[model samples]
Target: MNRSENTATSAAPAKITDSGQFKRSLGTWSTLALGVGAMVGFGWVTLVGGWINDAGTLGAASAMLAGGVMMAVVAFVYSEMVAAMPKAGGEHNYILRAMGPRWSFIGSWGITGGYATVVAFEAVALPTALEYVIPLDHLHLWTVSDSDVFLSWALVGAVTAVIITIINIVGVKIAGSFQMFVVLFLFLIGFLQIFGSLNAGEVSMMEPLFSNGWAGFFTVLVVVPFMFVGFDVIPQTAEEVNLPPKKTGRIAFISVIIAAAWYIMIILTVSSALTPEQQANSSLPAADAMATLFSSEFFGNLMVAAGVAGIVTSWNSLQMGASRLMYSLAQGGMLPAWLGKLHPKFGTPVNALLVLGAVATIAPFFGHKALGWIVDAGSPMIVIAYFLVSISFVILRIREPKMNRPLRVGGRGNFGVIVGATAVAITAFLITLYVPGMPAGLSIEPWIIFGVWWLVGAVFFVGIPGGVKPGPNAEEELMEKVYARYPHRRP
Candidate 1:
């Protein structure tokens, strides 16, 4: 295992240097809201429609459940780690402390790569959503090509990225508030659909529920993990929290439960409402499915609003998460020194946000389908990072037995932690491998894209001049900090 980079020693933590006026006072609810904001939008709303279209309704639902189970296990593993570590850079920080700096560099890239692909997914979908709600015929003057829709989508993506970058740079409080409102609204709308559909709508029995073969269910399972990845953002903001451990554990677990229940209701209602032909045919199947229960225009407008809001929140939350990881890396001497500088006025990581936004904004020109391909290809790396974190949990338990854990995983000694972590790690990897090759319509080859992304990060992390030099007593320093704050309790 390679050593971790933790050498950059400032006089004190950077938070002490800033005025701290713009520092966020977010708690469990806000963190949960951000997680829901990141994950709930397109994946649950529009993308579920797409998945169902490709695989039958039953196939997609089965896949969703399989993915959810894997996600639940991984979430438990991560919860244990976050409860112990409770800092920025998330898996980057965990992997380094356990495996070494070299692997940490790869972990950092894995996280950033995931965020960039998510941005691409949101950017591409935002415009397609707009066209569904409002026709762009009058604005044909701005159209550049035979495919006016494609041009419109690209512009929309770029514009959305700019807006989200500004929100992220402003700091977490504003961003958290925005996400809270959007996610709350999303939940309300979902609940409304459940109740409303039950009252007036004739729920047709989806006979032969397990319509998709075992292969199709497994295929959908691979793709479904991407939906859960966005929730990792909650724990990444641990440093910014007023109470890190309490807030992280409470928010993360609760948010997962809420999201799961909401998703179940949505799949049941939408699937039951629409016929197989209707589900397969429409691009915006959710809107069409709901239209049978409600008026067409009303359903379409509601979904468009939800989709737009979801993308904005997802983009903003991801921008914040990715930028913080950069700050953590730079402060550790893994990257350029300038990136460690927080914005003077806002106390936010402005430089990192700008860089992340630039990469994300450029991805949409390839079109919506291509953006989906990018997200799919990037998905494997994130699962790998989670698997590493799960492994790290057990290694850290044995290596740093005396290190104070503010929030400890309960059981006889470290046995439970090891078992939970190993289970989560193996399950995530297995699911990632289980999903078959990408469907025909998607652009990038899944294996090839995943390979290139990993290769590029490996070279940059190891080859570059400031290639993550490991610090002496890195683990000791972290242990001291942990113990000072959280003295071990005797049973």
Candidate 2:
């Protein structure tokens, strides 16, 4: 609070030294869609049957319910942090303000990697969905790990990734606009599927709810944080939101509930429509369940079609969110200076967007089935970011108790401690699921993927400019050092 402390900690913000900042164009609806859309990706279509098979129908539902609650607690922390500091880099800014630059980089690094992995997976997933609708693998493009990549399938993913990147580079509004439209369709079909099953769904089909006891429950429970990750997109895109801070926080939490309910309903409807044997044997259980309910294969394929909508929505939003993080880190002099560059005409993170898009464009070469390594790799990264954010929340509460919190979590004097402690406890448990000896231990392949990504992050982590303290002037101070270090660099 003292002048000397201020002077020593950070410098006054310099003039607009970069291309410019993100434009405030995303409204409440678009923002909400971004969150929900990112959460409901193709996971529901491909993984639901496996969830039921592993945990049983009742076990699956219970896992979602319990996992949803844990994620909701983490969302509470994010909502409050976003409300307190409505910035472009959601987790990056929060962690910086609470725990300084090193910790900030770690948390942001983990989450940015998490988001990037999903973007790549969706690239592969889109073509996989197309394969389901129509076998379009005409020209084979070599082979990787027993999976053959066809010219047509590879083209679909690569071209789509490029188009999505261009949309984002043009402006956040356009990307948000596309997200809003597709997510609406996704929701409509999802609602119809659930409603159509009401009269035909059988309760007797849901017997043997808990399979393999607690281990089965843990399998489904651990995957929730990864699936429920979209809610944080609200914060990642906070600066562009054209609503009040409180509303962004409120909509974010609401989106989590919506996504959780959607997943649970899908599980219930599919389980009820088909017998246990049917669930275990069927590759496309959700589509099959819809077909059985409506007595039409048309409706079943329609569900798969809706899942394609989900893939696009999730892919687009994650790119939007992740690029901002890359920009934020570069803006703070962590990564190369140009990665934070905004488009002079569009006010978008041009360089950062392209970097993510380039990698995603190559994902199709591996084929969709082999992309599980990426999804598994990213899940723990996301969980680690959540844990760090919770710790940041508690740190800020104690270090700067007077900081604004437009969406405070708890009540009275004990609020921050209670909420922060609870989030830490839950996320810690979630992290264990991927560790060795756990019920749902991750494979070596995923761990290797995770290691490679973090090593890249560590390069940037160690390169951050010195004396970068957490406060209003953090970015300003960081830029000063960056400009001073590289005199040739320009705004």
Candidate 3:
């Protein structure tokens, strides 16, 4: 192997700095917490029952493990990319460098939609989690999709959204610290459940380990990607991490491993502690399982509180990711340049934060019924971005073989190519799951939402002057045009 080809060139800096750069305040542990906190959100509390029902105990755990493996491959690709070009927009920088501006816009937009939807989902999820602990008075404010919209419930989500947004705007350190504290509590709850399950759970409840055969397994596998989606948040905020590039890359991969273990543990704990009939009767099976295992309702309520903590961690992290992506797009001339501006004091993307924050705050007003649709709609988009990034990984490996990779996957050889190729194949397979008639195909509503989002993206794509052309100078050209469009943003 040529040593010259192994080191990064000056063209790709270890740290990307500009007049409007973000504050590098996130340390190693904080960065890891960002990814882990985002991954271990409220889904486990509400979705564990469905996972058990669809695929039984071992089946669901297997699917989650499989999904983790697939995502781990993808994370390896991200690890190299982020290590090589540690920038604010994770996939944006990778895609742009490999495939140029047009495809970069598509990939960035795909992830932005994915992150935004999750932010909105968490906004609504917060209220839903609260309702489990303290029942809200229904001041009926209309309905959507047959689910009644209530003022009191919606207000809880909306207010939390505002507070979370403020926390982010205050600074990344504040948000990262808050995430670490909340994630610790979540881990404590997880430990309690694991210990309780060991003490009181019966193995008989785990019967029918593979329900409905392949169909059930595929159903669980399709959503596994979504559950493991948060690990990528590390790449989005790569520019703000106060750590070595290689360590940052390692954290991304580690987060995926932690999440895999977390999901598997949750499945085993839930299944062992509750019978099929018990799970069927309970809306929140994980909480019920904790309650049953500990023989106390307080533990169940404590589990619900953990779910709320999950919501906050996820909501805060995704908002940070989505805003940085928007800021990246604007800086690259894919979106309005004004969105690229950073706050002088906080060094955060205030304008972009406000825009996404506003969207999240309004999400609650539409009611919780749209949560499912938002998730399904966002799934394909997230996978699409992953697919494109996988392709970019291969492209960069072949095109810039000597490019510096602080945390190179598979070492400096053809093995890295094999890893990238595997990622491409896996993401391609995941994409097909969303197509109509597939075992894990999305519903018509999500399809419609997916179509509308792309259509909107197309409109923005057309609006760019002269359109973005793929080449060596694509980024520079795009930035030049952006500066021309918004002179005040020129830096």
Candidate 4:
């Protein structure tokens, strides 16, 4: 296979940043673990099952397949961008290079909100899941009553936030290793579920093809994007990868392939094991499906334990990745400078972690029902971000025709990858609006909160200094500053 000149050199030890705080310690498998850990939490357990129940097995599966395909196209485009720039800021860096500093700043605002919101969502999900396994009616800690479910959720979120912060501070090596373990266990549990259900053969996978029609199909389409969000996160770690662009792109492709197949198995297993009525009404569909297949008390409990563990692990990784991205953006002057400070000894952006924790901790009290709203608001934000990123890819290809692409998606002359990705972006945006106010039977007033948040983000992008449009002279000055700090990284 052909390789870029930097390919061989990339394997050499990565030079540490001047602050001596950031370094690239991740390998291919470690990168894959990061992607898996970010995407496979509560969504895999409750979200996917709930989705299947809403649209029926056929509609859910097809939408997931479609979403996965769309994400794959995006992965290809994103991989190409990261391979070229390999910066820690991920989408922020990509947008700046392709669109301009101003638009990139706008992109950073949305990306920051997405990461923070999702992390908070994950933190709250853990305690909510615990209510299923534990009977804590009268427990009290530090004069606080756990009786108020929201209080318990806040406490859990706080504790998990601390754990994630500590892990990130200790360094990427430790954090990445923990993520690897989480992914391994999650994969084992998922596979066990798929095989155990497949063995029963009590239900047919193809019994109903598309029972929900376009309405059902669109509902699933909107939710499936949440499940496949981790692939894009791979680019966020570009600067920390041993082979910045090439290795990052290759590992991302592997991650998408692995995650897609795993998610499909989950859909199939759940579909085969649950009846229509059981699926629709069941609170925890995957766990219920496993129980039906096994008819064993031990396995039933195992499903709950595995599901909770998955949520916790996913919560941890998402927070870590998101905070790091925010920290990177802040250092570039796209955000408040205070957000960029690293703990003197711990080597972490502890303040940023605290900020993210604050957002997530308070979110649950806003009402778990409101999470749907946050998600709805976040959905359009991501779609808009994706649209820009994809457009950036095509523009960059034209602007930098001589630029090296360590991994290109289509043939020499074919723009199918670009065209297809753009089409998916449009489709995803259209489908997303259908579930804007929440589907029937669900109250999603919290989306208003996100709507307000988006407006605030817009203001930040336009109001802050060096926040946007660094100007032509400023770009060169900024490059000289960045290079002076990291002399080892100069081309």
Give a tens-digit lDDT track for model 2, residues 1-491.
55355334322223224577679899989999999999999888878888988898889999998888888888888888887778787888888777777888899999898999999999998888777779877999888778888989898999999999999999999999999999999989888888878977778887767688888888788788778987888888887888888788888888889998999999999988888788778777888898888988898889988999999999999999999888878777777877878899998889999999998998888886568788889989988999999998888777766565667778438776788989999988888888877866888899999999998887877788778887656666666777788776645
- Order of models, best lDDT first: 3, 2, 4, 1
User: What does candidate 1's lDDT look like per residue over 1-491, in tens digits?
Assistant: 22222222311233212223236567666788887777776766665555555455666766676667667666766676666566666776777767766677677777777777787778777777788777534434233233343555577778878878888787777778888888877766676677657865554544346554775565566565567667788767777766657458666656566666666666667776776677667777666666766766687578667767777777777778888777766654456645656788777778888888887688666655556667877776676667777777777666665544545565438665766666556656654472565332223376567778877776656643322333324534543433343343100
- Tens digits of per-residue lDDT for model 4, 1-491: 12454343232212223334556677877788887777777767676666666566767777777777777777777777777667666777667756776677666666667676787777667777766677533333332222244455557665776677678777776778888887788777777897788788356653565666878877777665567666667777666666646778877766766777777777778888877667768777777778778887567667777777677666666677677677766665556656766666655666677787677666555445556556655655555666677777777566555455666656455583566357446645644454537442223444566678767767656643442333222334444454565564344
RMSD of each: 6.7, 2.7, 2.5, 5.1
- TM-score of each candidate? 0.84, 0.94, 0.95, 0.84
The segments of candidate 1 whose C-alpha lies over 4 angstroms from its true place after superposition are: 1-22, 49-62, 137-151, 412-415, 424-448, 463-472, 475-491
Q: Write out the backbone clash pairs for model 2.
A: 17-491
Ten-residue region with minimum lDDT total, candidate 2? 7-16
Winner on TM-score between 1 and 2 is 2
lDDT of 4: 0.65
Off by over 4 Å in 2: 1-16, 471-473, 488-491
The TM-score-based order of candidates, best leading, equals 3, 2, 4, 1
Q: Whole-model Cα lDDT per candidate? A: 0.65, 0.84, 0.86, 0.65
